[model samples]
Target: MKLWKRAAAAIKDQKSLLAVGFSRRASYRNTDLEAAIIKATSHDDSSVDYSNAQRVYKWIKASPLNLKTLVHALSSRVNHTRSWIVALKSLMLLHGVISCKVPSVVGEIRRLPFDLSDFSDGHSSLSRTWGFNIFVRAYFAFLNSYSSFTADQISRTRANLRSDKVDSVKQQLDRIQKLQSLLDLILQIRPIADNMKRALILEAMDCIVLESINIYGRICSGIIKILPAAGKTDAARSLKIVNKATSQGEDLAMYFEFCKGFGVSNARDTPQFVTIPMAEVEAMEKMVKSVEKDEQKQEEEVVEKAIVLLEKPRLQTIITDKWQTFEDDEYCFSEKAIQEYHQDPLPLVVSNQPVCYTMPDLITF
Candidate 1:
């Protein structure tokens, strides 16, 4: 049975290689992208192919339009494969692509082109590979959510940056909360049962660790922005976020510990926990109160000014109905004076002949 399986796999590999060799068309620049994708997601590869995955990411960076081809190729490979290994590998490759953070790529991948929500392994029975099937589904869910989350973050960042006003504390807090939710999702991507020690799963975990670090950084950045600018009303929410951030920090520390136990190398470099002083929160609240008091004082000053204006005597003018006359010279020139002053050059002509008038007699009834 093993021999037959090996022979079948070898034949499949040969056919895949031939297809890749012939796949160099207008859609791709060269055979490298196609070959890289194939090798990176190959079932025969005992471990994740980081090189090919990175290569694919570089191609995406060089030309984001290549995403269409990448999506099609990945979809075809993953959807047709019955092996959990290939599915996970393809997903990991896609995960690496998203890590590039290109605007176009992030925008385009806001929703995945393919579906894996109901993926089931065909190579093995339901009883044997159910764990893997679940793992793939969980991983897919995370990726889907992660893509949308990233796109939203990018859009909000661009909008805030373009605006004249500082980004609102509410918006910043919202972003942090989203990151927290994503972190929860990240925590749920653990390998199940016998697949716990698999190198490929560990690779995926490593990628997850990197993603966690990125999210943590963004959260820290958001907190920093919120702390100084937050008002009393916002300070309360900001405090909750701070507390949540601290809790999330601890959660991350524990998560790293989990990853370290699970053998993800990147977790070894997990940063220290985030801690915010209550003094800062108090300062923000006090500042908002002082600002409000100043505004009230200004309003009182304005009212006082208005009252003073009302108390002072107002100047009044009386209107008369009497008529007055002015000399013609002081006003308009008379019509006769105008005509005499500006005479016409042409002489007036008068008819010397006189005509007799005739009238009809009225009849009396």
Candidate 2:
């Protein structure tokens, strides 16, 4: 039989011996059985031996034996133990089996029968108590798992780095630097109270790193995209606008008009004018001239109609009532003199004519 198969069979058959107090009449002596178990769990360098150790460790962990018996067995054979794998396996099994009961309690609370208000009521006090206990257990379990996973990842990473042959020294150093930077950023963000904000920041970091990697890879592969010659193109365009402006008389006139409207003086000779191509200036001038000609034609037509109307000759109306007359002879006297005569308590003198009774005399009664 293979050494691995033999080791596995030995471990399986000796299970009763490894657990509670073994019967003295069992197949193998207690001392020999304990020796075989120690040898099986210990690292032997050979592939077959290591495989057997892994298999036995797995079987022992999955077994339904009580933890107290296992711990006792481990402690009794601690001196004979050649590896910590057995202890680790035992602890993992104990944790896994015992921890399974805690989550069901948590699920019960999570799916609680009563509403949130029931927490303060006396009648639902027992449910609240059990809910709180379960929540505490679940919270601690989560914290333990989180910490354990972090430690395991860190340990494995360190082991990989120490192996030395798997990667170059420079690559290892770069990875360490990146990890340090990540740790620093994590510390900086630790004080944030919002989970979503923290997650967004982490996601942004991931995206930035991935994009940078892609850009670097593209550069290394010599696949850079061509960009327009910025300096040459810009300079050429600017020169074109300036040359066009100097060539167009109408553009110069428009530019000066704009400057004047904006209160800009030409004393300093500063180029405050925006330039356009000569063709564009000519197009604009043509548009303006067309509009002006249309307006002038409309104005001339209106004046011609007015002249025709004047030539048609219409009769002017005259007022029959002398009080309603608007001729200048009605107001020949000085206004001040008339006002004074009216204010005097005497009648006006007429040149040898009989006085006629005015409407005011009849109204005096």
Q: Give the Cα RMSD of candidate 2.
A: 30.1
Error in Å for residue 238 of model 1: 2.1
What RMSD does each model have against the real structure? 15.9, 30.1
lDDT of each residue in 119-211, candidate 1, tens digit only: 898876788778888888888888988888888877767787888556567877787888878877777777667645778778888888888
Q: What Cα-based lDDT does every candidate model obtain?
A: 0.78, 0.36
Question: In candidate 2, which residue ranges exceed 4 Å CA deviation?
Answer: 1-80, 103-365
Q: Write one digit per residue (lDDT tens) for candidate 2, span 160-181.
A: 7788545433343333334333
Candidate 1: where is the Cα deviation over 4 Å? 1-7, 20-32, 160-166, 281-365
Model 1, CA-based lDDT:
0.78
Error of 1 at 65 (Å): 2.1
Task: Give the distance in Å from residue 98's predicted Cα in candidate 1 to where it truly belongs.
Answer: 1.2
What TM-score does each of the candidates earn?
0.70, 0.17
Best by lDDT: 1
How many steric clashes between backbone atoms does each model show?
0, 0
